[model samples]
Target chain A: MKEENVIEAEELTKAFGDFKAVNAISFEVKKGEIFGFLGANGAGKTTAIKMLIGISKPSSGQATVAGFDVYTQRESIKKNIGYMSQKFALYDDLTVKENITFFGGIYGLSRAKIKEKREQLISELGLEDISNKLVGSLPLGWKQKLSFSVSLLHDPKIVFLDEPTGGVDPITRRQFWEMIYKAADRGTTIFVTTHYMDEAEYCDRVSIMVEGKIEALDTPKKLKEQFKVDSMNDVFLKLARE
Target chain B: MSITLNHISKSYKKLKAVQDISFNVEPGELFGLIGPDGAGKTTIFRIITTLLIPDAGTASVAGFDVIKDYQAIRNTVGYMPGRFSLYQDLTVEENLTFFATIFGTTIAENYDLIEDIYVQIEPFKDRRAGKLSGGMKQKLALCCALIHKPKVLFLDEPTSGVDPVSRKEFWEMLKRLQQKGITILVSTPYMDEAALCDRIALIQDGKILEIDAPEAIVNKFPKKIYNVGADNMYKLIRTLQGYEHLYSVFPFGEFVHYTDKRDSFEAADLKSYLKNAGLTDISIEATQPNIEDAFMELAK
Candidate 1:
C-alpha cells in the first residue's frame, strides 16, 4: 500500500553559469507528509525549492510537483500549490479582511466562498476583534499566522513554507506547528524549509542539503540514529562539516 | 564586569520597549538575551552600545558610562546589528579594510584578532558583500566588528537566519574570541542557542522573566513533564486539553509535552487514558525539561 508521491525529483539540477546551485538531487515526498528541506546558508536549498515551485527552470534532470512537470505545465503546478516566505506577504496598509479578500481574489475563489472563508479564518485565528484593523498594526506572531492562513485560502494540494518561523518566539512557534499539524491532518502535503533544527524533528521526513547536493534524507529519528547523535542539530552539524 | 545595566528603561510613547531591567555581564563571558521580536532585546543592545539613549536608568560598557563616556564606550565596544550593515557594493576585503581604516588600524595590525574568521572568507575576498552567502556575510560582519579589537562585543541576532552548521561555526569563533578575553552579549530567539551561553536573561514584553545559567534555568522548571505521542497527534492534543489533571499540553517536535496539575500523576495513568481514548501506538515517557520548557513555565 504505497501512497502516491506528491513530489518526485530525479537528479534535479540547477546551474547558474559555472556554478551548479542544485546538483543532481533526487527525493520523493509522499502525500500528506511534512517534508523538511534543510541546509546551511548558500547550500542550494532555495535554488532547489525555486525549481520545484516552477519559479526557476532546472538546468538538467527532472521533477514533478503535484504531478505536474517542472519543465512544462508550470501553470497547473502553480495553481495546485501555496507558498509562504519568511517575509509575511500580507499588504500592511490593508485591513485583515481586505488582505484575505485580496489573496482569495487572486486565487480565483468565488466571492461567496471567499466571504465565508474570510469569516471562518478570522474567527479561527481569534482575529475577530481586529478584523477591521490594518495588518501593520498587528503583532509579529499574529501577522505570521495570518500569512499562513491566507496561503491556504485556495485549499492547494501542497504548501511551501520557507523559513516560516525565523524570528518568532518559542510559544508562537509551538502554536504555528499546531497549524501545520492541522493542515497535514487535512491531507495537504507540507514542503517546508527552516533553520530551526528542532522543527526538523517535527517533520515526518527530512532531507539535508549541502554544497548543492542532498547529503542525507530520512525520518528525524532514523537520521539521528544513523549519525549516532542525540539531536537533529548534531546530525546536521556532522553532515554539514563533511 | 565588562557590561552593567542598572534599572534601564526605554519607551516609545505608550509602548515601553524596555521596562526597569537590570543585569550584569562578566568580563570575557558569553551572555545571551533570549526573547522574541518586539521583546526589547534590540532596544537594550542599542542603549548599551550608546546608539540610543535610555529614557531612564543607566548603562555602562567597559566601565564607561553610556551617557557620559559615549565616545570611550563606542571605541571600546564592538556592535553587530541585526541587519547586515556593510557596504553592499564593496568587496569583502574592501569592506574589512574600510572598517579597519575607520578604526585607525590596518588589516595587518588586527590580522591576528580576525585570522580564524578572515581565513574562511579570504577566498571570496573579491566578491561583493551583498553577493556573499548568509554565512559569509555574517563572518564578514563579525570581522569588521572585530577589526578595532574592542574589549566588548554586542551581537543582535547574528545567526537569526543562518544555517545550523554556520551557526555552530560562528559560536566556535565566539569561543575563540572569548579566549582572547573579549566580553560578548548576544541576543537570539532560538531557545537551543540559549544553552550555548554562559548565562541568559529570558525577556518578554520589555521585562526579564528569568536570568541564570542555562542549566540552572532548566533545573528551575516547576513540574515533571511527560512526552506523549499517538497515531493521531491533533486528537491527542485535544483530548489532553480536556483531561482533568492536565496542567499544560504543548507540542514539542514529534511528541506532545504534558504536565499534570497533580504532582503525583503517573505515566501509566496517561498511557491508559490515551489507550482508552482509542489512540494506537501510544507512548508515554518521563522527560527532563529543556530551556523552552523552563521559558514556558516562567512565562505563565
Candidate 2:
C-alpha cells in the first residue's frame, strides 16, 4: 500500500506566528487518481499545497512526495511534480510554439525531444493555424488548454493545477476537464484544486479544507451521503459554514 | 426599459469586442450578461456605464443618452470592475469613505443600503485593502460600489475565484439589493449562477447567443440530454466521441451529458457499445438540460 501511494502526508502542519495554516492534515493519494483539493478562499489550501510541493517547510510533521522525504529531498520532490497557477502561466510575448519550446527547455527536455513533443502537442490541440501567434493573443480558453499541455512537458509523476478553469466558458471548462481525464488515463496523477463544485464531483476523491484543517475527505458520493446532501456544493457549505 | 442598446457595437482595431448587439434591461430587474472571458461582457458593461463609447449604435441608461448625457449616466450607475480596483494602500474604512466622499455621498447616507454587507467587513475596517482575503476584498468592493446608491448597478465577474460558500453569500446580497429596486446588470462566467438571475443574455464571441429568463433559457435547449457513465470517464468520453450518432459529448458531474444527432436515440445501443469497449459499471439515464446545456448547443 505504501509503495502504491505516490503522495503520503501524516500530521503535516504549517504555522505562521501563532496560527496554523495547515493543521496537521493527513492523506494519501494513489497513482493515476484525480484528487480534488478544495477549500474556502483562506482555508489554507495554498499553504498545504506549498508544503506538499516542497516549496515551504512544515512546522512539524512527516510527508513524502513521489517517495521522497519533503525536508531532505525538496529538490527531488520539485523534480517529480509539475505546478501551474491560473494567474501566471506561459509567457505572454512569446508565440505559442515559442512558449512550448521555452517551457520544454526549462523542463530539461532535449532539443530533439522538444521538437517532437511540439509537433505532437500542436497537432493534438489543433493549434497549427495559430502556432506562430503570440500566446497573449490566443483566446482565453485556448491559452488555458495550451498552458495545461505545456505544464506536462516534463511528464512529472503528478500535475498540480490551481484553479485551472477560473473564467472560461462552460464548454471550455469542460474541455479542460477532458484533458485532465485523458492525462489521468495515461497513468499520471492529477492533484487539482477548484472552486466549482461540479468539477469536484468529477474527482475520484475530494478533500475540503475549512479555516486551517481538512474537515472532510472522501469520495464525493460518500461525502454527500454523510452530509445529508445531494450535491458537493451543499457539502462544502456545511463544512465551511460550520 | 431601464436600459437599452440599439445595435450597439465596439471595436479595438481589427478585433470586434462587441458586434451589433441590442438588448433591453427592464427597471428593477436583475439582468445578467452571462458569458466567458473575451465574450465582450465587459465591453457591454462599459458602454452602459459610459466609460467607453460604442463604435456604432446608441444606448441609454435611466432614460439618459449614453453619449449626450454621459455625466448623468455616470451619476446613476455603480460599476464594480472584474478586477479589484480599490486603493490597496487605503484601509477598508478609508476606501469606503473615499468612494462615498468622491460621489458626494457618505457611508452614513447609504448605511442602510450596504449595512448587511458592510457589517461583515466592518471588523476589518482598519486593515489595508490589500491585506484582506479574496472574499473580503469582494465584499469591500461591493460596499464601495453601493455607497453612492446608483439606480443601476453593474458588477463584472464578482465571484470569479471566490469559493462556493462566499459566492452563495454574494448572490443573496444581490437579491436583497434587488428588493430595494436597484437594477443590477451583473456578468459572470459561471453557468450555474445564471439560474439566479431574473433574465440572462448568453453571450459568446462578442455576440448574444440567447436572452431570456433562466428557466426559459434552460427550457429552450433543443436536444434531450442523457447522463451516461461507466467505470472509466476517459474511456467513456473517447467511446462517446467516436459514436456515429453523436451530437455532443460533454463531461457533466459523474456522467457525460450525451446527446445524439438522431432524434430517436437508443440508450441500449450506447450501453452495448461501452460494454464491447471493455468497460463495466455503466449507467445511463435521461436527464433534463440546464443553462450550460443550452449554451453549449447554441455556441456549437
Candidate 3:
C-alpha cells in the first residue's frame, strides 16, 4: 500500500540576494509522523519551514502541504497548519486564556469551541492556577508549553514547531515531548526544526541540512549506524566536518 | 584568583530570578552554570560580573566585592553576555580595541590571550559586527572579552545560536583559555556541554537542582536502565507503561528505554512478556545514564 504523505516538496528553493537559503531540497513527511528538520545555523531549516507554512514564497520548484499547493493555495494551507517560531510569538502582555482565545479567533474558531479548548488546554497542561496570569509572568518553560498548547487550539492538521524547546529545562523538554506524542497519537502530523541533536533523535525521520542543502535524511538510528557514531552529536560532527 | 558567590539571589518585582545560589570556582576551573532560559544563570552571571546588584547576597571575583569594588571586578573579569551585545556598527578589530580601552589596557598587553581566535577572523576584522556569521560573531565576541587579560571569564550561553561545529570549536577555545590559569564561569542550556566543564551546577525554577562534577552527577542516577526495541514500537511503549514494574519508558532513538521500579526483574522475563504481547524483534539491554537522565530523575 502506498502510504499517504502530509507534506511533499519537489526541489524547493529559497534565495536571498546571491545566497540560496534553501537550495533545491526535496522530502516528504508521512501522516501523523514526527518529522524533524535538523541543521546547523544558516542551514535553511527556517526557510524551508516558512515555505512549507506558506509564509515565505519559494524561489523555485513546487511544494504541497496538507494536500494544498504551497504557492497557489497558501491561504488554504495556512488554515490547515499551525506554526510556532523560534522566537516566542505569543503576546507577552496577554493573559494565558486571552492569548489562546485570540489565536483561536484568528484561526476562525467559534466562541464555544474556543472556550472548550481553552479549558481543556489549561487543565491538560496544568495551567489552571495561572490561566488568568499574563504570559510574561510565567517561567520560560511554562511559557514555552503555553505557546505550544496555544498553537494547537484550532486543531490544525499539521503543526510546525521551530525550536520550541530551545532553552527549556530537560524535565520541561520531556513533558513537551509527551505533549507532542499525545498530539501525534491523535493523528496530528508534527514538523519541527531544532539545533538540539538529542531532540532530533526522537523524530520518526530527520533531515539534516548543511549550507542550504539537505545533506542527510533518515531515521536517527540509520544515520548513526551509517555514520558509525554513538550519539547524534557525533553523527552531526561527522557530517559537519565533512 | 578564585571566584565566589555567597547566597546570591536576585529579583525583579515579585519574581525571583536567582534564589540563594552559592558556589565557588577554584582558580583555573571551568565551572559550568547550566539551566533553562530563566533559571537565573544569567542573573547570577550579571551579579558576579558587577552588572546587576544581587538582592541579598555577596559575590567576590578575585577577592574583589562584586558590589563594593565594582571597578576592580570590572577590570579583572571578562564577560560575554548571552546575547550579542557588541556595537553593531563596529568592526571586529574596533570592538576588541574598544573593550581594551574600557579596561584601561591596550590590545598589545593581552594580544596573546586572543591570538588563536583572532587569526581566523583577522581578514574579517574590517567587517562590521552585524555582517559576520554566528560563528564569526562568537569568535569576535570572545576576542573582545579577552583583549584585557582578565583573571576570570564569564560566558553566558556563548554557544546558544552558533552552529554545531562552531560550538565544538568554541569549547575547544575555552579549554585552551583554562590553560592560561583563568577561572571560567560559563552558562549553557545544552546538557551535553555540561560534560566539558570541570564542575557544574544544574539550576531550575530559580533554584540550584544539583552541583557536582558531570560524571558524579550522571553516576547519581539511581535506576536500572534498559533499551527495549520492538516492531510495534508505539503500542509496545503504551503497553510497557501499563506494566506494574515499569518506572519510566521514554523514547531513546530506535528503542524505548524501560527502567523497572524494582531491579529484580530479569531481562529474560521482559523478553518473554514482550514476545507474548506480539512484539517482534524485541531487544532489551541495560544501558548507562547521562546528564539528561540524571536531571529528569532529580526533577521527578
What TM-score does structure 2 among the candidates reach? 0.98
**Superior by TM-score: candidate 2 or candidate 3:** 2
For chain B alone, what TM-score does every candidate structure achieve against the true structure? 0.98, 0.98, 0.95
* After superposition, candidate 2 runs with Cα above 4 Å error: A1-3
Badly placed stretches (over 4 Å) of model 1 are: none
TM-score between predicted and true chain B, model 1: 0.98
Clashing pairs in 3: none
Question: Model 1, A144: alpha-carbon shift in Å?
Answer: 1.1
Which candidate ranks first by lDDT, i.e. highest? 2
Model 3 scores a TM of: 0.95
Kindly list the per-residue Cα lDDT of model 2 for residues B1-300, writing each as its tens digit: 899999999999989999999999999999999999899999998888888999999999999999999999988899999999999999999999999999999999989999999999999999999999889999999999999999999999998998999999999999999999999999999999999999999999999999999999888788888999888888899988888999999998878899899979889998898899898999989999989899988999
* Candidate 3 chain B, poorest ten consecutive residues by summed lDDT: B249-258
Question: Which residue ranges in model 3 land beyond 4 Å of their true spot?
Answer: B232-236, B273-278
Cα shift from native, residue B87, model 2 (Å): 1.8
As a whole number from 0 to 100, the lDDT of residue B196 in candidate 2 is: 95
Instruction: Give the best candidate by DockQ.
Output: 2
Higher-lDDT candidate among 2 and 3?
A: 2
TM-score (chain B) for candidate 3 is: 0.95
* DockQ pick, better of 1 and 3: 1
